[model samples]
Target: MTSPGVHAFLIIVRVDRFTPEEKNTVDFIKKIFGDGAAKYCIVVFTREDQLEEGQTIDDFINSSDQLKELVQCCGNHKFAINNKLNGQPLKIKIDQLLRMIDQMVQSNRGKYYTNDMYQKIERQRKREQARQEEEDRKKKKAYEESLISTGREIGRQEAEERERERQKEQKSREKEPQKTEKPEKEQYSTREKICGCSCHKYPGVIHVVPCCSGTKFPFSLLGP
Candidate 1:
């Protein structure tokens, strides 16, 4: 009988004597459950006195492939119950199995099943960061280029201004007049002068006066 509240627990009880119907039931269980039934424990109940002198339960089921498959399907998890003894060991084993299941569930509690989703998110974040960095680099390069062009323009302007100032100075220098020094005046003394005239004081302005005979002054009498 299946309990509605105990969906995680699957109990399969075998009859005291094995029959075709019982074997068919076990087969049906295996077919229906498969690996899905690995969550449950396999409880094998047996009467201890029914066993042969040298035979063990492990030896008995070793030849049954179906039984082996059933145990393997449950991840080889099995607990034996001897009906002739107290059920303390079975209870303890069931408790331990439940604790293991609890631990498994706890360990996987925070685990995300979809690694692809996380990877996609991480990739997108990196791409966006790279794009932003590229944009920033372009903007910085453009700003530096602008500053270089401005500097060149300023240098050209200063050169033109200096050239204009030099031209203006050169033209002013050329337009100014150049001064010339006057020559010294010649000296004369009366005693050294010819015709005994005070040439220095009188500085005679000679007139060619005609005598009574109308004779002209000789050219040789004038100073050479």
Candidate 2:
């Protein structure tokens, strides 16, 4: 089916097994074959024995949706193959089928499908496949880059959050140190001094004599 440069495409569709999938295959095959797919295409219906008792292939075509669509895709070109036919009748059907093929070839300027055309088609298909692959790679790279960018953004946000939390903790610690601090006491106090004589220093008050003003004496100098 992948072979290129086919002048004619014979779509073998079973008369009895006609289904939507078969009908859909017509469009798919055309895609695989590319341009000039329809002109040389033919729809050959098999299993003609399953036709209604008095009905011809046309009757079947008229009754079935899949058959109608198949015929339409092949430019209304359709034929039936019944191997059961023998002698002159079989020959006649064969001749008819050949004549139709001949007409199609003739219409195509007697150009039969050849390897040269196939090679050309194949090369073109390869080029297209390469292009599509490149495009897919680019898309994949873009998607990956987007994921990395998103991850970086998330990491940056997380780092900022951690820094904010750290700053908040530091501020809280600073306030705690202030709140738990004790009142400042004087390093040097004159009240710690007393007279060296028999005079006792007033309680919690500073009383310095003229002679002991320069002296740092303990209040125990006045023994009880």
lDDT of each: 0.53, 0.75
Q: What is candidate 1's lDDT per residue for 107-159, written digit by digit as tens?
A: 44522223343345457667878999999999999999999999999999999
Residue pairs with colliding backbones in model 2 are: 4-118, 5-118
Tens-digit lDDT string for candidate 2 (1-224): 33344557788888767667778777776566656567788888888988879999898888977677778878888889885889999999889998999898888888776676656777888999999999999999999999999999999999999999999999998787445678798554445544454334544444443333455465543433
Candidate 2 at 86: error in angstroms?
2.1
Error of 1 at 173 (Å): 1.3
TM-score of each: 0.33, 0.72
Candidate 1, position 206, lDDT: 35
- Best model number under lDDT: 2
Worst 10 residues of 1 by lDDT: 1-10
Residue 6 miss distance in model 1 (angstroms)? 28
Q: Tell me the RMSD of model 1 versus the true structure.
A: 23.0
What C-alpha RMSD separates each model from the true structure?
A: 23.0, 5.9
